[model samples]
Target: MVRRVVVVGIVLAVVLTPLMGWAQSKAVLPPIMPLRDIKPGMRGIGRTVIQGQKIEEFDIEIMGILQGGGDVIPVRHLILFRASGPVTDRSGGTAAGMSGSPLFINGKLIGALSAGYLWQPGKRELALGTPIEDMLTVLDLPNGTAQTPWPRTFAASEPFHIGRRAITRVVVTDTLAQAQRVDEAGLPGMTAFIPATFPVMVSGLSPRAMGFLRQALGAAQPLLQYDQEGATFVASPITGGSSVGILQVRGDVSYGGMCTVTLRVGDRLLICGHPWDQMGEVEYALTTSDIVTVVRTLQEPFKEGNLGDLIGKIDQDRGPAIRGVIGRMPRMLAVRVAVTDLDAGTRIEKGVQVVRRRDLAKTFAAAMALTAVDRARGQILGGGTASVKITLRAKGLPRVISRENVFYNSRDVALASLLDLPDALNFLLYNDLAPLDPVDMNIEISVTGKRQTAAIAETTVERREVAPGERLRVHMTLRPFQEQTVPSRVIEISIPRDFPRGPAVLVVGSAGRQVSLESAPEQGLAQLLQQEPQPSPAATLDGAIQLFEDYGKNTDILLQLIPFGLPPEGSEFVKFDVFAGEVVRTDWVVQGEIQIPILIR
Candidate 1:
């Protein structure tokens, strides 16, 4: 049994909902013409913002309706229409960023402007829209069902820097425009209409950073417009047909999607007759938008708009429409990045606000760190070394997680310096021991335009045998890049006094190599060749924090003694246990490894 739902509100008289099949209330609201009553050739007007906050009108004619064939609308319905009017005449046709523009016929609301063709004839642009009944279905969804976002990970890849990259500006559209072939209403045979894509307006990122986003986002990368001066439009209260922004990242770096308001009932509003991120029941930051002008293009016309103040939060994203309230703000994580150019003696700081979703926050934080270093150094690619310092704070943690590392890369040193930040963030966000919320990350990077790296040439110890509780001096020879092997540096490693006397393995190498030696399990040749090194699972939040802190810097020479013996009791193999260890810091990034068999008496 299905009941028609009618909305009751003050601004307009509303009626008709056939999808949900619930009993109707006898309250007055904006009128909605049922899909059954709509017919071909019926004339109407649609509302959208062409410039500024003013909602303008465009003429529309009902062409046909696309019903359930599982082709257009699998569950609900789509109303096909052709758009024209003074506004359409000026802008050429229906543009992107007008996904939820409201349509009215005979003084009754019908649907919202959603999908359109890429190329349309003059004066008339054919489009499809979600019916008002379908759009209203979002209102019946269960509230407070937002789930914690899963952590995201992107493999580091080199950006294609072959040609000139376009500077991104302002506009929000769809990431994917679902293409459909329509054959009805005397339309140009088998015309394909795609849902209007929400192009996310972005600012402050360099060409390199934009390339990073493209690689990171892959096919779902939204159109990005670079704006030096951010959204500065005068504040305006949102209403039906007004422009709005779904801001994912803000502050120093602005990244958000824009769409038109379809309907407003009290404080609640329906928007974007399609999914923004397709993330249902999400809490994304919402904001008002001020349209500068409609960017009329031969390929696809779109609204060029700037994101305004953060005014509310969008709680639902569904196939029919996205829904939100006008006053409740969403939680945002704070990330501050500071970059210092050691050669130029200049520093730049950028503060960005990202949605509380750990995935977006972590990925964007790394990108921001790269951009900060690039902006400070005034270059994108170069051979250099960077000293990176990261401090992470969370609500439930007793103390902040702090770490520092030095990185060197022949190309894109700024990017190489940011490698482990996402892992650290993943540790905090994906840990089963604690729910880390209200996380704040601050990153500091100091860069020098020099490839400061050294490879281990030789390692020598005074004697291969040592008694318990005795200290031994191990000397290392480092081969610097394009230079002679430096004099051997001596490091002291103490042997722990114990009853067990046996053969021990002395490993001298970079921080990474030494850590692996300490944690490596006793395995057969096949297991050693097949299995990759993995971090030990932390049993507690404190343990996770300790693991994060224990990571050695790239500029560290590590010495460790691993006893060649049987596996520990209750364990399959000896793992992460060392008899003695010592860290020797160097000005250059250390590389390579050497192992020496020792007799412990």
Candidate 2:
């Protein structure tokens, strides 16, 4: 009987879920006043923030309804209105951050404050409201609906030059492209549709860190004048007119935008007077925030915000507004950075919950990790040797890559020490074998105040000629950083028995960097054809990791030697053009290209 009841319950749940969802989807929308019914003589009240976290009411009078393409609504209609009452008396004009302020007439919802003109002190404020009916259209969309022109990889993983290059071009939002979009909305000296800048609730950020973020994000940079934060962090809650943060990174380096809430219906929400990236299906952390204050200027007024607790994700960003679902937390990448100082016997470990993304992981990781190191050292500066080991834990990947690297930064030790892991991870994150789902990122960085590096200052060959099966010795003068030079040591190379009687040249340089190799060429055209662009399993995770290892790390020695009988062709490189592990990894970081001539007999 119990089994039957369980089976029947499952059957009913499966049968009734679609019915309930359909009924809900077809439900009547909230009371709304059509754009046609709105008149020039209509008077209404709107809600927004002018001072603090409070959502105060502002009086507005509809001046006219604009139907031209130049208007905010362009084709349909926009209720053009002017500000009045206490809001005007205090603020002097409609502010930029007041975009999402809801407007109502006769106790019925009309629209949200969407567009604004340049504000002048002691002048009546003019703005346009987006119809509420347009916002409700999102609620009826299919669950899997995606925003048009999806986000795709455009650039390689380089600072400010990665992701969706076909669109953004140079930066995440290229200055030229972004300026064009911003201009299309409205031109200065005329009433144009303006999207309010969402407040970014930031904390524990240094000027250097801020500069990095602005560089990465491009023209969408935050207006620092409205920032409200300090060394410590505070949690913001969900309230209309209050700020909500879309966090990209949290901890040493924090980045995110703070948007205002317009309305809430059950678990569904409407926020930000404008769109946030317009990424159709996205999972980004949404946190609550408080308006620290308002920064007023002739250009425009903006609201400063202090971030608070993470709420949920604002999923759908459309034309007029962004919709969010509360209580659904977005997935984040887990990171742990441990910085240890050898001399001081001190170590600090900071962890961050970063937005998991291939385009952003490397940059954000570097920023956050550097911040942690700087803060731990009281912002001191110096060059030092660093050893970095990284472990990447990912889902669906067959192997976890554990890569170790060493660097001696003669300039800034703290920053240089933090470089290898993030740089290496860039290739891993942007690998073509689908997107890597990184569950955890762990980095162990050990730093020493002293330099632990060496280079070959000079080289001398003991003998110019040698018989086959004989060992040839080459002496190298090793120079240590800021230390006494070590006496020359001999490196032996064996002449193979099969070598022809001829002369050969051996050129050695710092390995891994500018490294080239040679192999026997195909004797036949058919064999040579097979060497061309063949498909690579390098498209897989293991293959991608191997690719990263080969070109990413700066370690070992690369020696290009012309064996006795081989011809010195146009291009010395025997390019196999396949994913192969480093064929020549040296224990020491070798430098300089020393050429030595040898005669094989």
Top candidate when judged by lDDT against the true structure: 1
Candidate 2 C-alpha lDDT tens digits along 1-601: 0000000000000000011111122223457788778887689897766543456888888866654332232333456677778865665566545666778888777877765544234443766666777666654555578554311112211112112212111111222245345546553222223444443434444455545545554445442422333422333234344445556666545556555566556556666545655655556766555554555555555554455555566667765577876777778887888888877877888777777665456656665666666665655466767777888777766777777767665556665655454345654454456666678888888878676766767877788888867776776676666667877766766655665567777655554322121121111211221222223335466765665555434455444446645543322232223101113353444455677777766
Error of 2 at 120 (Å): 2.1
In terms of lDDT, the poorest run of 10 residues in model 1 is: 1-10
Model 1: lDDT to the true structure: 0.66
| lDDT for each residue of candidate 1 in 199-293, tens digit (9 for 90 to 100) | 65566677767666655555555546555553344545566687777768887777766777888776677887777666777778776666666
Q: Which residue pairs in model 2 clash with each other?
A: 154-164, 154-165, 199-258, 235-308, 235-309, 236-308, 236-309, 511-557, 511-558, 556-586
Each prediction's whole-model lDDT (CA): 0.66, 0.54
Instruction: Assess the local accuracy of residue 185 in candidate 2 as a C-alpha lDDT between 0 and 100.
Output: 56
